[model samples]
Target chain A: MGMKLDEALVRARRALDKPAEFGPDLNVSEFAVVTGGNELALSRGRDRLSLVGVDLSDENRAGSYYQVDESVVGISAKMPGLTVLPFEHAIEEGIIENYVWELVPPDLDKYTALNAIYGRRGYVVVAERKRKIREPVQACLFMSSPGGIQVPHNVIIAEEGSELSVYTGCTIMPEVVGLHVGVTEIYVKHGAKVNFVMIHAWNEDAHVRPRTAVLVEEGGTYVEHYINMAPVASLQARPRVTLAGREAKAHLSSVIVAKGRSLMDFGGLIRLEGEETRGEIVSRVIAKDFARTTSRLRLEANGIGCRGHTECNGLMLSKRAQILTIPELLSSVSDAELTHEAAVGKLKEEEIYYLTARGIKRKEAISMLVRGFMNVRIEGLPSKLRRQIDLAIAMAAAGL
Target chain B: MRMTALYVRNLFVRSSGEKMILKNVSLELYSGERVLLLGPNGSGKSSLIQTIMGNPKYEVVSGEIYLNSERITDLPTEDRVSRGLGVIFQMSPVIRGISLRDLLVKVSKRSGVSLEDVRAVADELNATHLLDRSLNQGFSGGEMKKAELLLLFAQNPKIALIDEIDSGVDVDSLNSVGKVFQRLFSDENRTLLIVTHTGHIARYVGVNTAYVMINGRIVCKGDPKRILETIFKEGFNKCLECVGVGDEAR
Candidate 1:
C-alpha cells in the first residue's frame, strides 16, 4: 500500500540534511521548483530528444511517455497489451499503489528523500499476464527550465509469463542548470521477462542522482542497461537487483563516458537470494579529459546452489583522466559460488598497432577500439533497439 | 632485368631499449623473385623483417630501406603498410576487440580482394571458423599461422616478408598453408622473402636464392639446393666452425 503524503513528508525532512555516500553534496535549495515552462519536449526543442535516443517520428515503439519538468506532457499507447500512465494518474487509479516506495526506501538518502517529497511526474508501465510486447515502451524525461528542480518516481510491473522492454532517455537542454532526482521500482513476476535500457545525456552544469531497484520472482529474468555518455558536474548512482525466487536470473550492465572535468561514481549490485538462482553485473567505463570516475560491481550469493559473478572493466583515454574499479563477491552458504574480476587500464598499444598495420588510419582504429570497449551485448534484445544502442555507442566513442 | 621490389643497404638496427639487433646487413629482392632466408635460431632474421616493416619496436640505427626502389627508411608503419608492404609475423598479437572479419573488411577495400575470394581462401585453409573470433585470441599454433596467412592473402601486398611460416605447424596445417603460399607465389609480379630455420617451406615454394645467417651476419649466399643439402648433411656446427676460422663462403 502507498503511504500517505504526511508520512512521506516526515521521512523526507529527516534525510533532507543527509549527505550522499558518494560525490559532493549539491545545495538542494539553490534549485527552486519551476512549473510552467510550456515546452513540448517532442520536437520543438531542436532535436534534444534524439540526442538521448528518442526518435521524433518513430513508429516502432509500442507506446511513449514524455514529461517536462513536473508535468506530464504526452502519453500514448499504440498497443492494448500495455498500460502507460503518469505517476499521479496511476496512483489515482489505484493500479500501482503497492509498488511505489516498495523496492526503494523513501529516506535512503537526500536524493531519494527529495523524490519522496516531490515526485508525481514519472510514468508507470504494466504488461498484462502472458502478453508479449515486442516493441519497446519508450519514455523521455526532459528538463528545459533553467535553474529548475525535478523529482520523479517511476514504477514498472511485468505480470506472470509476460515479456516487456522499456527504453528511458533522460536529457537537458543546451545551457540549463538543473537538479534531477529520479527513483524507480521494478517488479518481475513468475515466468516473466523484462529488458530495460536507460540512457542519460545531461549537460555539463547538471547534478543527477537516480535511485533504482529491481526484483525478480520464480523463473523470471530481468536485464538492465544504463548508459551516460554526456557531461555532468556531479553524478552518483548505484542500483541493486535481487533474484527472489527459484531459477530467477538478472543481468545488469552499465556504460559510462566520464569526460570534461566531471565527477562520476557508478555502481551495480546483484543479490542471489533463491535456490538455483543466478546473477551477474558488468560495468564498462571510459574516462577522458580531466575526468574522474570510480566504478563498483558487487554480487552476493545467499541461497543454496546459487551462483553470481561480476566484471568491472575501465579504460583511460587521457593522461589526466583517472579510473578505479572495485569488484566484490560475497558467499554465505558452503555451496554458494561467487567470483569477481576487475581491470582498469588504457588501451593496449599492441592492439592499436595491429589495426594500423591493416591500413586503417590511426584515428579510425582508435575509434573502433573505443566503441568495441563500450559495447555490452544484451541477450534477446530486439534488433531495432540494438541499432539505437550501437548509435549511442558510436556517439559516445566519438566524444562527449 | 626485373625491377628491385625491396632493398636494404648497410642496415644497422637496434631494439627499442637501444640494444643493437641487426648489424650492417645488406640484401635485395627483385620483382617476381622468391628468396629464402635460412638461419639458425637467434640469428636476427626476425629482427631484420621487423625492421623492414617499419615496426617502431625495432629502430634503424643506421642504413636505408627502399620499397619499389623508393627510399622509405624514415616512414611510419602506417605509411609503409599503405604502400603495400605486408608481412606474416613470427608471432601474431591478440587484438581483443577486433575480429578477423572486421580487419578483412577494411583490407578488402584497399587490396581489391572481394569477400568471396576471402571466403574461398579461408575455406581452403579451414579458417572460416576464425572469421568471427578476435584477431588471435585462444588460437592454436596452426590457427595463428593460418590467420596470419588469411590476412596477408586479403592484403595482397607488393612485397611479402614471411617470418617462420613453418614453425609450430602440423603436417595437415602445413599442407593447407603450403597451398596458400603456392597461390601467392603464382603471381609473377609479386615479390617474396621467406625466412625459416627448418627449410620445411622449401617443399611447397621454389627458392631462386638462399642465404644462411649466423651470429647476426649472413655468412653464405648461394644456390638453395646445395646450401640446404649441406646444412642438412653436416649440420649448422660446420658452418659455425668454418666462419670462426674466417673461411666462410658467400
Candidate 2:
C-alpha cells in the first residue's frame, strides 16, 4: 500500500484532533449527548424504525443489504452482480483496498473523534459498468442501545454507464440519548446515474451529524432526496455535490420538520466545475412548538454554460418557533447563470379564512395548508418510495 | 306573511381603522325573496354584505344580524357559515398552494355534499378544467366569479349573499350563474341577497325589491325594475334627488 493504514489513521487523528467550529451558535465543542434511562424497548424501537421504511427481521437475507445496530449485524447481496460486505471485510478482501479513507479524510474534529472511537463501521456498494440494478440496495442504521454512539462510513460507487438506486434509513429508539456521526461518499462515473433517498427518524434526545459528499463525472446525473420529519434534540449537516465533467447534473432536495424545541441546521451546496454542468437545490422546512430551524442552499457556477438555481422556503407554525432561510448564488463566468430565492413566514390568514369559509374547521385548514407547504414533488422517485414519503409528510403534518 | 330568513337591524359597522363604513343599515328579506342591493362605488354595499357574513374586519359596533332568526353578529365567520350563511366576494383572495379540487373536497365533506355534486357544479360553470389548478391563482375575473359560484353551490347555505357576481363576468358566465341562482331560489326556504352596481343581472333573475344605497345609507326602496331602469338610464344622480339628503349626509 502506498500509505499504510496505521499511518493514515495517525494522520487523520492529527488533522482532526479538535472539534471543528461551524459557526458562532453551532460550535461542536459544546455539543454533548446525555444518556441513560432513555433506552426504548426492542419492539418500540422496531415500530419507530418502520416509519422510515425499514422493517426489522431475521429471516433469510435478501437482495443487497446492510443492517446495523451498534455494529454491523447483517450484510448480504442476493443479486449476482452486486458486491456488498462489511467495511473491514471489504478492506481485508481488497474490494475497498483502493478507496478506503480516500474520499472522506479526517478533516474535522467530529470525523477524527469518530474514527478514533467508532465501534462498528462498514458497508460499500459497487455497481459495475453497464449494470442496471432493478431493486434498490437498502440499508438501515438503527440505534437500539441508549448512550451508544454510532459512527458509520459508507461508500457507494456507480461505475461508468451504470444505474442504481439506494434507500437508507437512519433512526434511533424513542427517548434514546445518543449521537450519530455518519460519513457518506458517493461517486457517479461517466454516463451513470445514482438515485439516493435518505430518511432520518431520530428521537427528541438524539443528536445527529452526517457528512456527505458526491462527485458526478461527464454525462452523469445524481439525485438525492432527504427527509427528517421526526423530532430530534439537535441536527447539523451540510452535504455537497460537485459536477466535475461536461454535462454533469445534480438535483438535491430536502423536506424537514422541526418540532418540540428541536434545533436543526441543514444546508446543501452544489458546485459546477465543468462546462455545461447544471444543478438545482430545493428545501422546505416547517418549524413548530418552539423549534428553531435554519436552512441554507448555495449554488456556485464556475464553468462556461453552467446553470443553477436554489430555492429555500420555510413555514413557521408557532409564535415561539423560528426559521431562518439563506439562499446564495455565485457565478464566476459571465456565461454562467445562477439564481436563488428564499422566503420564511407563517401561514397566510387569507388562506386559512378561505378554507374556513368553506365550512372546514380552522385546525384542519391549518394542517392542510402546512401539508401543502411541505409537499414538494421530486421527479424520478419510484412509486413505492413516493408513497412512503407521502405518508411521512402526512404524519408530520398531523403531529404538528 | 312569509317567514323572515335574514334580518339586519340598526347595524353600525366600522372598518379596521375604526372609521365608520356602514351606518344604521337595516334590511329584511323573507324566505324565497330575492333583494337587489344597488349602489355606486364606495357606497358600503360590499361592507354591508361582509358585515352580515361576520367578517371581523367589518366590526359591528352596534346592532344585530340574524340568520333564520338566530343571532349571528357575534359568531365567527366559520360559525356563521355553519349556520347557513354563504357569500361570494367581489374579489376573493387567492389561496396559494391549495388546488380547487382539494378545496372542493373539503367543502363537500363539510357541507354534507358529495364530490360528484361538486364536480357537476364545476362542470356547469365550465370550471372542471380548473379543478386541479390552484384556487383563484391566475384566474380571470369571470373565472373567479365562476369558481366562487361553484363553492356557493356546494355549500348550499340557507341564505346566499351574491356580491357583484355579475360584474366583471362575461355574458355567458352571467347567464349560467343566473340560471343556477334561479334553480336554487326556486325553493321557498332559500333566501337571496344580490349586490350589484350595474343591475344588469335584473334582466335574468326576478328581484322582489331593490334598495338604493348612497354614502353608507339606504336612501330608497322600490320595485326592482323601476329602480334599476331609473338608475341605469338617468344615473344615480336622479335617485339622489329622490332621497333629499343634506350636505352632511353626502
Q: Which number leads on TM-score?
A: 1
What is the per-residue lDDT of model 2 for residues A1-400, given as tens digits with 9 covering 90 to 100?
3354665666665654465444223233333332231224334567776777765562322344444455565566766567777666666777766665665565565554565345236478888887877667778777777676767777888899988777787887777677777877889999998888888889888888887889999999998989898889888887889999999999998999998888888989999999999999989998889899888788888879999988899988789999988788888899998988888898887777767777777888888889888777677776656776788778777767
How well does chain B match by TM-score in each candidate?
0.94, 0.93
Instruction: Give a tens-digit lDDT track for model 2, residues B126-152.
Output: 888878777888999999988888888
What is candidate 2's CA lDDT for residue A121? 66
DockQ of 1: 0.57
Considering the two chains of model 2, state its CAPRI-style docking category: acceptable
On residues B134-225, what C-alpha lDDT tens digit does candidate 1 reach at each position?
A: 77888999999999898899998888889999999999999999999888778888788999989998878888888777767777767788
DockQ of candidate 2? 0.47
Worst 10 residues of 1 chain A by lDDT: A37-46
**Model 2 scores what on Cα lDDT?**
0.78
Distance from true location, Cα of A73 in model 2, Å: 3.4
- The residue ranges of model 1 lying beyond 4 angstroms of the native Cα positions read A1-6, A37-41, B232-234, B242-250
lDDT of 1: 0.85
| lDDT of the candidates, in the order given | 0.85, 0.78
- lDDT (Cα, 0-100) at A8 in candidate 1: 71
